[model samples]
Every structure is written in C-alpha cells, then in structure tokens.
Target: MAVLSFDNVSILQEDVPTLQQVNLEMNEGDFAYLIGKTGSGKSTLFRSIYAELPINSGVARVAGYSLNDIKRSDIPFLRRKLGFVFQDFQLLTDRNVEKNLSFVLEATGHSNPDEIRFRIEQVLAQVGMSNAIQKRVHRLSGGEQQRVCIARAILNKPLLLLADEPTGHLDPEVSLEIMQLFKQLNQQGTAILMASHDYNTMRQVPGKLLKIEAGRIFPVNSLD
Candidate 1:
C-alpha cells in the first residue's frame, strides 16, 4: 500500500513559493531518500506531508489524511500515525529519554502505563537504544541522541517516518550508522521518507532517489 502520496502538491511560505507541483510516493516497507542542494525545497516538501505547511494547491495524503483538505482538530490525530524526526534532535531539555517517549505516548492517548512502557521499550530496542533509556538526552553522544529520536518516532508505531536531515551533525561514520538504522526500520515494514542534502550518504543508501531542482520534484535522472 502507498503510505504517502502527493499529486501536484504546492506549498508557499509568506507568498514565496518553496515547492511547486510535487508528486511522489513511498509505499509500505519502502525506503526513499530526498536529495537536493540547499534551498532546493527538500524540507519544504517534507513539511507539506505532515501538514506543517498547508498545501497551497493539489492533494497530499499521509497515512490517509488529506493535506489539502483536513480539519484543525484532525491535525494532531494525523500526526499520531506519522513519525517526524529532525536533524537537530528536538527532545525536551528537561526530560530524560524515557520521559520523552512517554510524553508522546500520553499525548497520543495511550493511557495504560504498562502498555506505554512496553511500546517505548520495543521502539528503543528497535533503534538499539534500549540500554540508554535512563540516560539524560545531553549525556548521550550525537549519534546516540539521534538513535533515541528514531526510537521515539517509532514508539507510536507510525505508518510512515519522515526525517529531516537526520545526519546533519554527525561524522561520516556516524551518518552511515544512522542511515543503516533508517534502512533497518524500513525493512521491518515502516515506510521512510527522509530529506537530506548529503549527496554522498544518499548515494550510499540503498533506495530510490528523488530530487528537487529548479522548483520541481522528480527522480534524479529526470533532472537530466
């Protein structure tokens, strides 16, 4: 099944166009990399998928929620089934690793504490962060923190995972490790859509490649 679909999607910020007529798809258990130079609308495209930027035109559906026509109240619910990870590691400053995952579970309506704990452990283990759950966020290294971010994203058992420049701050080896982690998640039936400017890393990862160039989104070879 197609976990995400965008048909003629357009997005603008403050009357300036960032993305234009982007149509893409990432199916279940699929892994695809978003590649482009700076200002190539990579992040803008990712934002449109989760409704961070309202679709100015055309249709976008993520986990069955239409971006062009969706309710304000429905936004939070839409997010529950879609995992979003950032390059900057957006964990709460005051919360420990466990607390961060717990916060998302409670927010998403997982009231049973025991079930939530199990879910958290499951995701952390999936991302190889099971041993670091009790550690504070800052205490972990950059790669470890990113692994924790991945753990939290999958805790909700999302149908799709969207990561934005996931390896921006890591060294080459660490970035490779992070990409492997994403690939592992994809293998386990979680569709992944990641936006990154890391050309080398994107080339290394085994997945289809999509690129944004000159205000258009299409496959890399199409640009030629």
Candidate 2:
C-alpha cells in the first residue's frame, strides 16, 4: 500500500483553500522533494498530510489512515507512524539531549527504562549525535541540534519522515551533512518527503520533485 496517497484533494488553512484538486502518492522507500517559493503552499501540503490542516474535499490517506475521516483522538496515532523534522531544531531548551529524547519515548508509551535508553542510543548514533547525549540543547551548535531533532524523529522507527526545510538554518557544509543523513535513512527503507527551498541541495541529493506553485502541486524534472 502507498505510504501516502492524495487523490483530487483540496487542502484548507483557516477556512481558506490553499491547494486544490491535488493528487499525489508516496510508496514505501520513496524519496520526494517539495519545493516552492515563500507562501506557495509547500508547508500547507505538508500540514495536510499530517492532519494539522484539514482536508476540505477528496480522498487523503497517510500511513494507512484516512485524513478525511480521522478523529481528533486518532491524530496522535497517525502521527506516531510518521516522523517530523523542523527547520528551527525545536529541541526543548531546558532539557539535555537524552532527556529530550526520553520525553518523546515516554510520551509515546515506552515505559521500560532499559528499552528507552537503548532506543535513544540507537537513534542518536544514527544521526551521529550519540556522544552529545548529555549536552544541553543551548550549548549545541545548530547542526548538532538539528541532528538531535532528526534522531528524535526516528526514535519510533516511523514509516515516513516529513522534514520542513530541515537544513535551512545550517551552513552549506552542515546542510550537506544533513542531506547525507537523510539519504542514509531513505536507503534504509524509510520513505521521506522533505520541503526545501535549496535547489542546490536538491541537485546534490536527487529525488522526485514535487513543486508547489500558486497553491498547486506538479512534478518537475529539475528546479531549472
């Protein structure tokens, strides 16, 4: 089954339709790039996939759950099947790296201390942040913090990852590093749909391009 499928769907934010008659899909192990100008509806499309923005019409299914019929209580369940990485590196400022990750594991119902610790270690290692496990969020560089965010996102072994300009705040070198990390994850069978404005990064890490323009999405061979 498709990890994400949208068929003739319309997405709305604050009662305003941002994307109309959209049709898209991502299968297991698919890697797709979402690119668009500012306010061109890239984020809106992402929000709709995760149910943060409501679907106004047509069919939308993600990780086996139908967005059109998702209940409030079911939202969390659906989210658990996906990972989200934000550009701001939204780590808990007051917590250390391990604790920040532990908080998510606990919230997601991981109760055994050993298992939680093990999972935390595993994901941190995946993002090459295992050594920074005890570092305070405030002390880490932007790249390290973003690595932590990526580690946190994969803690639950999500089927799909949704990244919103995850390398936006990093330097060129760091951005390349992050893109490599994402590629590694995709190679390991995790489907990824990332929204990025960096056309150079897209060239470096090629994938199916989904471009949003004037609130519509269509495939393109290249940003050029």
Model 1 C-alpha lDDT per residue in residues 1-224, reported as the tens digit of each score: 88888888878988898888888888899887777888888877877777889999888898988888889899998888899889999998577899999998998888998998899899898888889888888889999999999998888889999999999999999999999889988898999988877767766776877878877878865222
Ten residues in a row with the worst lDDT in model 2?
Answer: 197-206
Best by TM-score, which number? 2
Q: For each candidate, how many residue pairs have backbone atoms clashing (under 3 Å)?
A: 0, 0
- List the pairs of residues colliding in candidate 1: none
lDDT of 2 by residue, 14-101 (tens): 8888999999999989999998898999888888888998889999999999999899999999999999999998889999999999
- Residue 113 miss distance in model 1 (angstroms): 1.4
Q: How do the predictions measure up, each by TM-score?
A: 0.94, 0.97
Give me the candidate number with maximum lDDT. 2
Model 1 bad stretches (over 4 Å):
221-224
lDDT of 1 at 215: 78
